[model samples]
Target: LGRIQIKKTDGTLILNSLNASDSNASIKGLEFDKSLIKYQMYYSGNAECNDKGYVYLFFPDPNNLNQMKLTFMQEPDIIVSCPSGYKTL
Candidate 1:
């Protein structure tokens, strides 16, 4: 199980790893910044982007940071199109 927190002002979110039935998972209030992903995509050589592909990011609870669980699920597709002369390049 996981928990999510969002700051209403700037769309900031903090995701915690407190599951419903898991009693051993605690992070001691470990938090992650959204910029971590952005930097990885931009500067850090941790991630890469292609014309069509998938991206995955994961963080563990501070207490169980060493433990990991991997799952796969299907998500809805999102589409964005430019209007008029707008360009994404």
Candidate 2:
């Protein structure tokens, strides 16, 4: 699996791939208040394709709103296929 980190500073958005293999990932856009972070990612080789997705961070605790929790969403085209007995993860 690959990992990425998103950051916002002075109205600027930054995306960093925690692993070298994920360097192709990049941010497409973001909401003004930084409530949403959108990015597009590409997959090749065994899982050849591309998709768009977004990550949102929410705070569950009303008292500690500074806490962070992450959620990821993506709607991919049906062009992707996995080998028999294997599933997308």
Candidate 3:
């Protein structure tokens, strides 16, 4: 599992890795809105095999009730690698 912390004042992002085996974790890009108090982060490197993808973290303005809704734009793709004749479900 992973943990993310955002500083409200300056939109600073903090990523915490709980597992000892995790490495090379980082944030690739970030978009922050000071006025709306919202942010989107593109991150990668949480997997053991150096998988590439985006981990988006969104924070909406607390005052706006409608903006508080969460939405999933798309389903994540899962990839696995193994020796020949090995089956994965």
Candidate 4:
């Protein structure tokens, strides 16, 4: 892996590669609110935001990734903003 490349999708790159395979990758933390609703079809996972005429999501680097259950699951790349705004569609 000796090339700088980009993986564009849904406004965010699910996986970014470094020039070298050993290079480190940074994935931010994700927080889900109890009031937030989850709309899988819209990739919206915040009930609070959903009820507030908005939606949000984050690709958090779960501190305990090992504890995560990933069984052929594909997560969303674009983390919604918040009870920030409503989706047109």
Candidate 5:
């Protein structure tokens, strides 16, 4: 029941409102992996999908990682990504 939501400017990656806990769901275009230890959300086109991809990893942020919003890039020109380990309300 998730949907593609926003598109970032920098990487032109698609951002989506995906449920990380949904084992049957796909973030960006990859299968949802509950064991992926997602500390941060990633939006990239290079992630398995030819156009969109989402990855969850610990991004290096000065402030609290949870306090920040999703990050994006404008190059790959083809995919969508989202965060994991937490439900988007």
Candidate 6:
């Protein structure tokens, strides 16, 4: 199943978010695949458990949809905010 494999600075993996892609996100995911992966960025949101919060940044790949990774933040403080349609990955 599709999942968010949260990672850490010390190179650990954790399951932060267990959310399935909504209908719209499923379609949007396909579109995201078609576009070029041009940047390295991060997105932050509330933590899942005892952890403060987390950050997910796109792991780069050349035309590969499965090429992604997450580096979990012990204290996921909001670093920045983007526009409505702007995506971190």
lDDT of 3 by residue, 36-55 (tens): 45454444543333333444
User: lDDT by residue for model 2 over 1-89, one digit each (tens)?
Assistant: 33555566675535455554534434323443434332223222223433345555556665786776655565455655545565322
Q: For each candidate, what is the lDDT?
A: 0.30, 0.46, 0.43, 0.32, 0.41, 0.40
Return the lDDT, model 2, position 59: 62
Q: What is the TM-score of each candidate against the true structure?
A: 0.19, 0.39, 0.30, 0.18, 0.25, 0.28
Ranking 1 against 2 by TM-score, winner? 2
Error of 2 at 26 (Å): 3.5
Predicted model with the maximum lDDT: 2
TM-score of 6: 0.28
The parts of candidate 6 lying over 4 Å away from their true place are 1-50, 76-89
Q: Pick the winner on TM-score between candidates 1 and 3.
A: 3
Q: Write the per-residue lDDT of candidate 1 for residues 42-63, one digit (tens) a residue.
A: 1111112111222233544546
lDDT tens per residue, model 6, 1-89? 22445566787754445565543121112112234433322323322322233333465664677876544445534635444544232
RMSD in angstroms between candidate 4 and the native structure over all alpha carbons? 13.6
Pairs of residues clashing in candidate 3: none
Candidate 5 whole-model C-alpha lDDT, 0 to 1: 0.41
- What is the lDDT ranking, best to worst? 2, 3, 5, 6, 4, 1
Residue pairs with clashing backbones, model 1: 27-62
Error of 3 at 70 (Å): 11
lDDT of 1: 0.30
Provide the global lDDT of candidate 6 against the true structure. 0.40
lDDT (Cα) of model 3: 0.43
